[model samples]
Target chain A: MKRKITLKQIAKELDVSISTVSKALRNSVEISEDTRLKVQAFAKLYNYRPNNIALSLKNRKSNTIGIIIPEIVHHFFSKVITGIELVANKRGYNVIVGLSNESFDKEVINMQMLANGSIDGFILSIAKETLQQQDYHHFKETINQGMPIVMFDRVINEIPCDKVIVDDVRGSRKAVEKLINNGCKTIGIITTKDYVSVGKLRTQGYLEALEDHKIEAESSLILKVDDKLLSENHLESLENEISNLFETNPKIDGIFAVNELYAVTAIKVARKFGLEIPKSLQVISFTDGVLSKHSMPSLTTVSQHGQKIGEKAADLLINRLEQEEAIEEGEEVFETVVIETELIERESTK
Target chain B: MKRKITLKQIAKELDVSISTVSKALRNSVEISEDTRLKVQAFAKLYNYRPNNIALSLKNRKSNTIGIIIPEIVHHFFSKVITGIELVANKRGYNVIVGLSNESFDKEVINMQMLANGSIDGFILSIAKETLQQQDYHHFKETINQGMPIVMFDRVINEIPCDKVIVDDVRGSRKAVEKLINNGCKTIGIITTKDYVSVGKLRTQGYLEALEDHKIEAESSLILKVDDKLLSENHLESLENEISNLFETNPKIDGIFAVNELYAVTAIKVARKFGLEIPKSLQVISFTDGVLSKHSMPSLTTVSQHGQKIGEKAADLLINRLEQEEAIEEGEEVFETVVIETELIERESTK
Candidate 1:
């Protein structure tokens, strides 16, 4: 069976704006008879039934914004939602969240479901799977259909939309530099495999920090954990991997983890080895979440300020959605906003 | 400024189903001529222009479910979302989430926005503020309008809908009994005020455990902490309140906290007073979340199995949505499913 065509395809095929195609479909007097007939003939030829026409045709504002994230049980993503809600609610827009669970198919499905008139616009973070697959057609299709999308956190450069991101490279560098300044001779870094955008950037930051300090980076000191470590079933292996890092590198006095879980796990393993924190093994991780604040000795962390990123994303999407002229003209101007991260000191760091 | 008349209000006034009113307004042959004319006359009297008709008239399935929770930056809630997404995606349904931020107004607004043709059904936890106000009209209105709602976790008995909850009282009682079995003489309880259903039930469990053990319950040992303590702004005050409980009850050898935050906070305070966990002060709290597992000494807790609750709630809501026979008959069969909780033993308790 052939895939159902959309107004976007018809508009592109007929060499007319989406709004003009929409008007012609409704036989609006605003469009000339010749243009209306041409658009209608094209739509008919393609068997375009306008499956989601009700979403666009509804005059009453849904006044709700949809946010799609890769995961819900994540510290940074949750904080971003909180921030987005704060701004969206204040501006008379309700926010709905969709979790992709790090699957590319789920991400595309969520966008399609939300874009079908359930929400006025979308604010989202790309899933790890989506980024790795490098398939951005879903995003392009949604944007082409005249729905505003603002991406945050795990965003890709290929998508031409407003984005909010923390400088992962700089944030990681600052965290690693802190460990260096605390008089560490050797430092180990725990991070995800390079397929993840943030993990790659954070690893880069670690490498840059070591080079800046004139310390030769040891490949063995960097442990690239598999993404499966995120699931509960893989936690034991994650702990084992970190333990091997400690056991293999007995001289490693400092560690930097890309996220909170890895950092906390490192501390747990360090304690098992009878190493005292701060005094014996100073550690710093990214994301100042509940685990960071309440862990034993509490964790020294690089706070990505997730809420600020959320607020910035909301502002961009809402601004775009409310601009009638931009919608009419189908403006393609996009922006990438970077929020600053702060390094937090705690008992885990001297 | 007259209040806009909704299909719900018209259905109530006309003593007909919302579907009937919707059909008559659209001049559908599904309604008899006499009934249609009568409905049309009533609608005209109320100046109903059917503002959200597009939402109701569209026969196509949205294939989406909406979930509203009090907060997102919470371990329990996030886990619940994970479970819901797992079940929802497997069932070919997409999930959308809204955060109430524990506010009554936001909760009502979110429901209204989602109900306006955005989602097929809802699985939600009540906002703290909504429970405090005892206002459940939005819930009643949605149910009346032929929408299915499945309440979970922070649910109330007032609403007649499907519910998924853990036996909070029994869970708490088991935790307290474990503390008593560890040979504690005086046990202090840290919980929220009585308005919160979970807190009240957990407190009752604490009392029942003491009563079952033939130990007299001391009113002074019970510290009803303000709910605001959950936020970072009031953490210092929360710490002070728990400290006072410790200072005032010098004989207190065990503690039972209703939530993970309170339990971890108690551990922090107990350490400040030079008290060793499991040896000097045995402790157990409800909800085995991230903080409990990674906290110093690793807390013993009542595991609520949040994922199970989410899965059950989603099943209930989705089942109701897909049952065309039930919708046609306006069936009101409601089931309250109680999930069991487990007592997890850790180093914080003997």
Candidate 2:
């Protein structure tokens, strides 16, 4: 087998120090441009490439960002990751992914494991349980150790770091207001994440929208479903819950489902109960998935642009890393970007 | 900030050479167990973590794997990723993802970018275009460079690497036989990926099932919907094609959709024509997404066990990596695991 060419071979041929050859390849200003070009030409001829590990060792930066997401099945997080990868790749960095499965302990352990110089920085969407428990010391310790972090989506406001978030409250409020303007009176809300900050904010928006229109917020109309019930046996509990929802409120004129799955279920359940969509119940939901665009009535949704969110978060982290000057040690709040939530009126809501 | 303790600090305090301290930390067999314990204890006390990049340089292993997926928004790929992350995390490996977006050029570029010592191995599910083109050179080069490759789901038969795949042929066959048993004489197969290997196999299965039931395979009943129409906002084209499908085969009593999204559309189109599910037109599909489980008259589908496929692929890759001796230079074909896809009797096909 032919031996692979090493940086030492280029150095030996050039009659220069190995460090000089390395510097030239890196296009370091310390090396003369003529010498750099000469070294680069020779390296190219021999197909000589410096070991990335060796380079990372000398620099103490891997040019890689670690991203931990709770789940990737959802369209919102998936687009966010695509956006992050797009920016990270363009900026000459790689992204490593860790799935927390929405476990707080797993999130902490992942952070601790990646903290040992595996990446230059971290861009994370905290798990649901992590936000609920308020256990953010692991993230705090990482920041304290001089590692930069940028949190997105399910983030804890308490942790002092750069944060890029969707204005969930505003988006929800806008959704509710739009439904109200379309003459939906008794708007019923379905949310699985009542404990998490984003979920709470969205619910708050629902209440605020109701108050803005002088409609009383009824506790009975607010449905709080847990993740366990959602995951167990293919929507058996969800079907039952939807059945009860209709049974309890035959007079309900509109529905606002917080997630795509719930919106789909609402559409299905409403259809089964002989409620004519748009005419009987105007449905508007959060987090558009494939189902929303293809359901029987072809759902109306508030599309959370996942790709844009991911891109913004990556840009923030990469920018911070590239900036040579030390940033002030405090929570840097990135304005919660409200990507326009276009109410996609389809057969269900038209 | 206080200077963090380094390897130099531990070595100086222990009166040991830096190399010996490093070796001891690695629990090298050359070092006595007493020295190992002492080094570990001191390292723990000082929180001395050997730089990850430095260790990678010495070992020539990144402990990071590159995962190239077609798209994350899809349920099968997302769930498979969840399973892969589960195993990869346990084994102390981090995965970096690259989206191929179902483009051959993108897949090739992703392979080229990761080939330069960025990852220890590559785990991929080939893009539809890649399969259609029958391209294997990009994959071949990675293997030649001694980088392990594991392909899953939409895999190539010729690629000499570890693979994880579900028996699409058998699954489709089973679905058809079940529909036939339900007393449906005329069946329509909806597929967008007629060029890929999996699509071909599944189509064959459908034909075989028809032949077994002594039903003629009618060319007109085989709806070859364009792949781009499935994902793109070309709803009009799809609606026209779906309308044409029903028109071509007015006696089409059952529909077997190759994917869940298409199946959901079939349900929608059928409803637009005022056809009742199961009683008038039975429907079944593959890759159980939320749409399948939650659609009105909830769909019956052939469940592709994504997590199991992921687990199998990871196990195969790790087994090869950990083998005491060098691997033989031919494709190690892990049996195409035929995870039995049961007929999920639901409201639609009941």
Candidate 3:
């Protein structure tokens, strides 16, 4: 069987990164001269074809939209896809999905595979590793090839493309303000590390709300948990971390978490400490997922309306595709539509 | 600005189902002669080309696997994808996903789009509508065209392909027997209608377990919920239905639900009735999802090992694809690999 060489294979054979091989193949300036030359020679030997999006887009229409999500077992992404499908079907286009699994190389690989004449445009969330590495070159290369992309949720500010995002900071601020108004004195926050854009923005909202109320911010009350420890299957670490937070901040009267799982887990841990919800500690989380709605005592939270974001993203991509000819002859304008978030009050709050 | 006409469009343009249009295109006698001729003529007029899978296979190897799932927002399906991706990545094959959204026409259209030289073979779970319609010409046609397929979870037995499934009957019987062993006198069951094969099998297991224990089965105790009434966002109907079950049978001491949502909801309703879990009432559900773990009082449920099913399905498909040359030269063998299920005890069961 004569299998075509892929960037992943080349990287494995030459003991380099997929990004390095991709850059070297494109003759990027960032790659070292020796590595680039070696990479080029190996690719040539294996007869590697990079699945050129530009050349493939020169003729024919697939009329399919490709969406790359960071993870598959996520509620928000699933809702977004449901929204995208409802609109795409009405607009006479089909949708396909690729998973990046939060890896930088996988993200690049999936984009290349989907862009290889399989789809007309893309709707994607930035992968965690790509954001951490601050690598936007693959995205720029695909757009340069004349394929339209609409990014949603986890988007980059510098990317010159249409984006649909929820007002993360404002939503978080609303949750914090609600807690303050309910007579919460010492509020604590459970959030992700600063690298994740949404988590960082949400943390900023908490800080801003505290400053507005003239409450002294305490570092001891803030718990920045590792995202890896937050998987639904193994939540012992998450529970232990929240337990430690309660142990250290005995005066904490309110809690704001970046997601529902953390908020629900905190409630479970709080029960061990014999603190009654709403009366002793009020809790709010971001993303109105199933956990918040189904958990005992429920939870007050922020609703991102993921489906609306997905619908808007599909419309933007399809509109851009239809206007490609006219846009080629005129100046291009990209829009960022912010989907407003709402706060839902439940038993966790006063 | 030209676009290829799809079966979905042909069906819409004419007043026929997508399945009818598909059959008419392939000259299946099942379609009425008048409808067949009209469909063929319309397809011809619009330059619609049914993706020729075998013809594409002769010239190239895309080395990509296409997986069509019934729904994306499901935990079991998501876990399966994670498992498939893990092994597929290790084995050097990439995966692309198409969603059917539980519709028959969308499943046909997605298969056509993916089969159009984008992927080498398919791994899919049948859509709900397709199962109800009982029109499996699409799978047969694809197989006849020299394309291999691997089915998982909700699969049909007649399809000559590799399959991965859990022992639904055995798993359900185990859950019921556990409840019985805990000294529950009168037991009830919550399941889907007979149209869904897994639900039917689980119900059968419940009945068999009752029969083996010399307990008379009561028709009043069986609550077959409409699948449409079970969406997470709108739980009022589901709650009402479960509440009715409890009201009708005040002496019910045990319950076995086919899925986690129903089991968790039953517990919630049981709480409303002031019945304590594991004492006055015991509950068990199938499919160990986050709800089973996170719900107050948790749940004792059947674990299908969805990731394991996915891994097995991928291995089967890749093995068959790699051995196509040998398979064609010699005898072909199809497999149905059954993944075993285990019961995880939690707060819901004593």
Measured by DockQ, the strongest candidate is: 2
Which whole-number lDDT from 0 to 100 does residue B54 have in model 1?
56
Per-candidate DockQ values are 0.18, 0.47, 0.11
Query: In candidate 3, how many Å is residue A30 off?
Result: 55
Q: Where's the lowest-lDDT run of ten residues in candidate 2 chain B? A: B324-333
Cα error of candidate 2 at position A340, Å: 4.2
Task: State the TM-score of the second chain for every model.
Answer: 0.82, 0.89, 0.82
Q: Which stretches of candidate 1 lie above 4 Å from their native place?
A: A1-56, A60-64, A229-231, A324-327, B1-56, B60-63, B229-231, B324-327
Q: Where in model 2 is the C-alpha error above 4 Å?
A: A1-5, A9-49, A228-234, A271-273, A325-340, B1-5, B12-46, B228-231, B324-338
C-alpha lDDT of all candidate models, in order = 0.85, 0.80, 0.85
Query: What is the alpha-carbon lDDT for the whole of candidate 2?
Result: 0.80
Pairs of residues at least 3 apart in sequence or in different chains that clash in candidate 1: none
Looking at model 1 chain A, report the run of 10 residues with the lowest lDDT sum. A51-60
Q: By the TM-score metric, which is better: model 1 or model 2?
A: 2
Residue-level lDDT of model 3, residues A69-176, one tens digit each, is 898788888889888977887796767777888889989988876665567889999988899899999898778767789999899999899999989999999999
Candidate number with the higher DockQ (1 or 2): 2
Error of 1 at A299 (Å): 1.1
Which candidate tops TM-score? 2
Better of 2 and 3 by lDDT: 3
Over B1-350, each residue of candidate 1 has an lDDT whose tens digit, in order, gives: 12356788889988999999999999999999998999999988865654422543455445678899999898899999888888887897777778888989989978876665567788999988888889999898777666779999888898889999999999999999999989999999999988888999999999999999999998999999887435666888988999999899988899999988899889899989989898999999999898888777889999999899999998888887778434566546799999999999999998
